[model samples]
Target chain A: MKNFSRFTLLSLLFLYLFFGNCIVGNFSSVYAQDDWKQEYSSVCAKTQNAMILTPEELKSYIDRCDKLLALINELEGEQAATEKKVYTKRVKMCRELYQFALEYKEHK
Target chain B: MAPIQKLLSAFIIALTVPVSASAADYSHYLRHIPPAENFGQVVLDNYSHKAGVLPVTFDHWLHRAKFTCRLCHIDIGFAMKAEMTEISAADNMSGYYCGACHDGKRVFDGRNIFGSCAENYTEDEGKRCARCHSSAEAEERKYDYKSFSEKLPKLPGNLIDWEKAESEGKVKLTDFLEGVSYKREPLKAQDDFTIKIRSWDVIFSHRKHTVWNGCELCHPMIFPSTKRGTTKYSMFQIMMKGEYCGVCHTSVAFSVWLCAKCHITLVE
Candidate 1:
């Protein structure tokens, strides 16, 4: 009887380890990851509020950003020929504007 | 004495349980890739009550026939996993969710789509609701799996090969939904470039993605707007079934084994 008890305890321990590990892995796969809204501040909520735009407006924002990026890439090739400091400042401004459009799309 | 018998019984029960469960075919019906029927129906039935009614069904086969899965799941706004999206009737009624497609004028049966939301409810309206929530019904088994799938256009490769069909001009997705879209000129396609993978020498083609996904798919969601490199992802996670690129790779699209398509230069 005593031997049987010992065997029982050993079996339970093995079961616990095996089942416990499976459960942990399964749960992690199902819900372990997080999304942007959950991780980021409610600033996203604020951005979505008040203003409403059609899909066209949203696409236009994406287009504007792409054009800006293209222009920046083009200017980088000509940095030596152009006025150094002024061109650099203009590039920075364009990049910043591009980011604004990007953020607007996200917030939308 | 009595307690000892109880412990012994418990041990025997536990030992048998795993063996029995393992013998049962939990995934028997899901062997070969099931065609993209309204999989969301079964998915919602299995999980929705615990989650919410927003477990609205999204049929991939029907939509992919006309539009690419990338248009909705990738572009419009949808989570790859069923019941994961935080959908609401208000969102749909306000031109979100199912309303994105069900809008009355754009396509068929769009007006009656407002059934998901109404100030008052009745017994008859529940019938229309079953159009989506049909998994629990007795008639569900009536949908002959073989017959229904055979009727639908075979996906050529995976039942969800959106890019292949779209590039062939088989699918024409309406990027601009009337009443939903304001108005904007079409954006020019950017020259395709390789997104060099870290560690792995995989090359992701922007052109390939655009063929199916168009620009809207990747722009604000997967990569996010403006915050470059913010979304950290791993091939392992995707393989293990964390949606993203895996939603297709594991189930439908191309198997991950075709790594050379994405993964480039192998270190000699």
Candidate 2:
């Protein structure tokens, strides 16, 4: 009976360590992916507001986009297809916003 | 078999676990070399390519040859990083940032040079737009770097010896602008100090830097004027974070490959 209790306790401990770590790791990874998407969206919003900015101010915003792009690149293989598409779209929007700011005239 | 042994075994396993496979090799970053013409050139494309306009290729060598680094970076508020400055067409036209000097009226020598990104450009004048907006492949540079630098005395590296050029009175740096700059008495620069590192001592020269970059360039921004040694920095931070000496030394001022320049004092 003592041996049975000892074996059962060991099994429970093993299960806790193995399954708990997997669950925690998976949750963190998902959380990080979501965080990246939110970050990209935030940068996109900033890029949209490029019209009112000076040349130097616009450059800093574009730099933020570049940094996000770098982060997305690091998550290349691990990223979900949907997430990848969203990131790509955000990057494109940022580029377009930057281009628009370049030739943007106040009068015409 | 005991709980202590089991815990010890787990700890050993954790310690033995392999690190990340994608660990970056920092050596490659330290060894990067920029092309001759493209050395200090930064592509400002915050919105150009997106707006169907070509990215503005700003060559530092071209500008630095004529003006001081402090003029644009400090006074004009140009960011050190390329594409980091959000310059728009309207901003330049109002005689701010690039427009401050690039205005056609600003005299360089005796010529009334054409204005930068002129708003009311004629059909014939439209062709001149490509002068600044030239792509990587289609650059139409008026001054050849090699030919221009040839007359100047040679330095150890491929870069033009800017310090020597300044010392010889070849390049006269203008510190103050008429409307833009608030004139004040230049602060008496502190004497050169030596900072000790592992087996080497770095001699920091304030005199050489103050010639082109006034106190405003480094003080209170890159390095605090409050007190010396208060801000803690490391070589890793300088190389990675692009702080301290890494700001200019890595790309424009001089390549970090010239180790002997700073790491002069060697311990036995």
Candidate 3:
């Protein structure tokens, strides 16, 4: 009876640790994804608001796109087909937009 | 007993819980270059194959060499999409669609052009039907795209640098058609503006686009010119082969991949 109770206790403790770690890991990943999405939305809004961008505004825009591109690259491997497409598109847009900004600044 | 039951239920739940998993393979359609002769050619098979008729092959390179895009797409009221116009034998016979130019009465280069798709034809006349109905392999074209493009000045890519050719007076595009287009005072093009798309500023050149397209070509059709910010378009939509800019950029004109062309501005 004592051995059975000890086994039960060890099993319960092992399950608690295992499931606890899993839940924490899942929550953290979800949180990280939400943060990345918020950052993307904020940068996209700022970009759209600027009609004729000043040099500083353009630089900020380029910087944001670069940051977003990095995040997209990091997330792309884990993404589904549809999510990967969206990320790939964002990456292209970011790269092109960054290049455009650099050229405009040089010409200006 | 209750504690053991709870542990068993918990293990079962853990094992059955769904994980965020997906198949890793992902791909997007990339445009491929067709042979010079077949570059702008399209095979219309909407109702043709269903009705047991061979698909109609329309060549943009052949027609665009003689007439402007506006002449066929705007003035003649042909839809940008193939087979969307629902062209019929009766419609052509009534001097509409292809009949407008292919009536045989219309003189081109001081010679009468042959009539197209007549309803009634003798065995001898039926032989002429093969000219258009012929498959891509069987068609004997009068003009060669390579020879025609070679005579004009060269561009970087395989496609003809139409904008440069037009600017250098190598090719002159006619904007009007008799009995089709109405004469009106041309509106002055709007000043160029920088459209902020994502983190980049794309310089929208009104003067450059208007040179070949004119007002009617884009107005109220591909774009609504009457209102500002009324139509919202995205690069994602364009990349997905949606309308607006992709109509020309993906197929005929310089591709969207050439970033420096439109996105001329830079950040200091």
What DockQ does every candidate get? 0.02, 0.01, 0.01
TM-score of 1: 0.47
lDDT, each prediction: 0.45, 0.63, 0.58
For model 3, residues B95-183, the per-residue Cα lDDT tens digits are: 66777777778788688877766777798876665556556655444556677787665433456767777778877776666654434
Sorting all predicted structures by TM-score, with the top scorer first, yields 2, 3, 1
lDDT of 1 by residue, B1-268 (tens): 2565546545633443343333223232233333344332224434335534434444454454565554465324555566554555545455554656654434443333233443345877655555555453335233433454453333423244455555666555654444322232334444555455554465566556665554444444444435434455555455444345666565445544334445555321
Candidate 1 vs candidate 2, lDDT winner: 2
How many Å off is the CA of B22 in candidate 2?
34
Residue-level error in angstroms, candidate 3, position B7: 42
Candidate 2 docking band: incorrect
- Real interface contacts reproduced by model 2, as a fraction: 0.00
Is 1 or 2 the stronger prediction by TM-score?
A: 2
Best by DockQ: 1
lDDT of 3 by residue, A20-104 (tens): 8899988988888877766654554332223245667767766777887677667743233333334444434433443454454
| Residue B182 lDDT, candidate 1, scale 0-100 | 27
Q: Return the TM-score for candidate 3, rounded to 2 decimals.
A: 0.56
Worst 10-residue lDDT window for candidate 1 chain B reads B23-32
Model 3: how far is B159 from its true place, Å? 0.6
| TM-score per model over all chains | 0.47, 0.60, 0.56
Which runs of model 1 end up more than 4 angstroms from their true locations? Answer: A1-108, B1-55, B68-85, B103-106, B109-115, B119-122, B136-158, B167-170, B195-201, B224-233, B241-244, B247-268
